[model samples]
Target: MVKQFVRQKARNITPTQFIVFTYLTAVMVAALLLLLPASVKEGKSISFLDALFTATSAVSVTGLTVVNTSETFSGFGALMIMGMIQFGGIGIMALGTFLWLIFGQNISLSYRRLIMVDQNRSSLSGLVYLIRSLLLLALLFEGVGAVLIGSYLLAAGYYDSVPMAFYHGLFHAISSYTNAGFDLFGDSLQSFSNDYVLQGLTMVLLVLGAIGFPVLIELREKLVKKTPNFKFSLFTKVTVTTFVTLIILGTVGIWIVESSVYYREMPWHQQLAYSLFNSISTRSGGLATMDVSEFTSPTQFMLSVLMFIGASPSSVGGGIRTTTFAVIVLTLVNYALGRSEVRVFRRTLKQEDITKSFVVFSAAVMIVILSIMLLDALERQHFSLIKIVFEVCSAFGTSGLSTGITSELSAPGKVLIILLMFMGRVGILTLLFMFRSKVTKDRYHYPKEELIIG
Candidate 1:
């Protein structure tokens, strides 16, 4: 009966609106669950604001938290948080479709439309297969990650018992793979900063989660099926190239900026590991082995830029998206060279795509700047401008890493962060579209006129 009511109501709304409503509903449900006495460590009730904030963070897969994960939340609460991470990471529509399949319900056209919007797909075709593949791939990756990390945690004596080790391992696996940034360890893997096995496994999961699901599907087709002369789509090529390039640039930038500063006394291997881990983490993983505050100003600024870039489109992570960045850069380069058209990988870019990319990028910049200004005004006496900017970027990108001011944020500051997280997850354009009036054909054209150039 409830499902029927929800479906009926959802049918009345646009897909973008439906997606926003779904996440809001999830946040409310998770908040209520976390409010239960059994969810807390000492059976003490948590404030409604805190519960809502944490729920929003989890459902948004943003890791900014007011309370410590290990000390405040009991096993049940942690599991609830983990479940929200998976829901947010994979998307509510995918999970709904998976359950519908299990219950032998027919997927309607409306359902497919919702999935298309949720996954950022251009077409409704093969959505069911896509959902199935996504669930299976997620389970396989998280399962293998759990086993590897769990066994290693047990061997390393991180936990007193196998069950505890497995629980933490599973939590970390889900969190890292989803790029949710939640951690069972109090310091967020800091104790194992030099643990190459753990960091390496985590980095792999992070990349897989943030690289976009379509890319993974394409990779499977090419690598597993051994498709003859399989070629990646333009989307795949752009996303992958931009993703790898950002990682390399971030790694080198951090190493150069921090080598003579923070990592001066550390061994070369440890320095390399820290640089690589931080570079990846800043891009949306959120797990930190060292305090971000320890880094120099230049490194922190670079991280803010990386966090702003975040991850790829149609993936767990957030930001303006890699393709948008790529398109904007290409457009600028082409314009500077006086090229007739923007081109990439031997293919001419669509003007519509280029325009949309700039729109998205411009809106993102505006939002981040406005958010930083608001945060600075609210918490100027408590924190520096850079810290406020970092926090704002982290919230907007859903990257979750902080210079330790999350807990100190005032009520208004927290609320602002919550809005930013929601906007980041739902996307700037989607949220803007919700308020935009419907469009109709103009059926007429205006005379062309020259305008002043820059």
Candidate 2:
């Protein structure tokens, strides 16, 4: 009877609720797996809470760790974390759907709805095709990335043995492509600071991972299949434009603030490299060429802002997302120019899209501010406010970049960060919708009123 009730309830749950539960289940299972003795190093032990936190971080693709990943996790544990990163990067729903297809099981409407919500799709058309392409592309990119980086490491004598070199390469490749900031390298990409070739490859993979899948699909269509007269959607245009614009602004912004301070005596080339790589990573890459704690407070705040904006929608990373940020900016521009509606790329934006954008932005601001306040209250005595703020934004954005204070936080602080990471991964909109009723609507409308404009 109990089993029947659960089966019945599962069938009737809303897509949003189902998504939450699915991700939650994944986190719990991963946490339990991490708690096993085989998953830890010979002398290291892990508490359930720390395991949960690490699991959440891994499944969210957020790299914030309560323990040193390299020192704590055994080889099996590291491999498990990599698997979780891949699973989280592609999504649990995508993986389940892929398995179903493999077994030649039919994908029903219910399955499609889950996929739509998981991938943040607006429509239900061609979902099966999308999953197939996603899996295929993931393989192609990861395979090529591992070979290039691993082979380079071996040839460059970074690793004496072939297996170890390729294993490390494969791990880093998955992490980079998934925007999963977890690293086997103790200092992230810091040891490779002067290795332009590795840095360049990693950045390319990061961008590809965070840039929305829709844009990638369309690009693949045009570039690979040579689709004739292919036109880009408004979403792709806005997303790409905002994404590129932010990278430029972030790079320039970092350079500007650092020029008179940290980079005062540094050469121009090194300065550019640091500025550019940090800018890109700030937007969800999480990998770093240098210690971010060395930067001025202003620069750290700047990095926080980019993390809050985050990667493009339908991608691995999180925040309010690039489109949401773009919509808010465009709306302000339209109003300032005496226009009524947001317009871009020769197309007018829908009213619903604009409203939803504001909703996301407002909710994100509220959540982020509250989390920062709460963390400040808890840990301000031990850490700087700027560091706390950066950490909070990092959790919410799922960027995983930290100021070396992650492991030192109080128990409550770590829990708060874990919740923030979960929220960041599943999204603010999802959380909001989880409480909304699916069966109820107002039968009659009240008279509308307008307040004085700001």
- Top-scoring candidate (lDDT): 2
lDDT of 2 by residue, 337-381 (tens): 999877898899999899889999999999999999999999989
Clashing pairs in 1: none
For all candidates in order, the CA lDDT equals 0.90, 0.92
User: Highest TM-score, which number?
Assistant: 2
Name model 1 segments beyond 4 Å from true.
Answer: 1-12
Cα lDDT tens digits for candidate 1, 15-105: 7887888788888999999999988999556798899899989988889999998989998999999999999999999999999999999
Which pairs of residues clash in candidate 2, taking residues 3 or more apart in a chain or in different chains? none
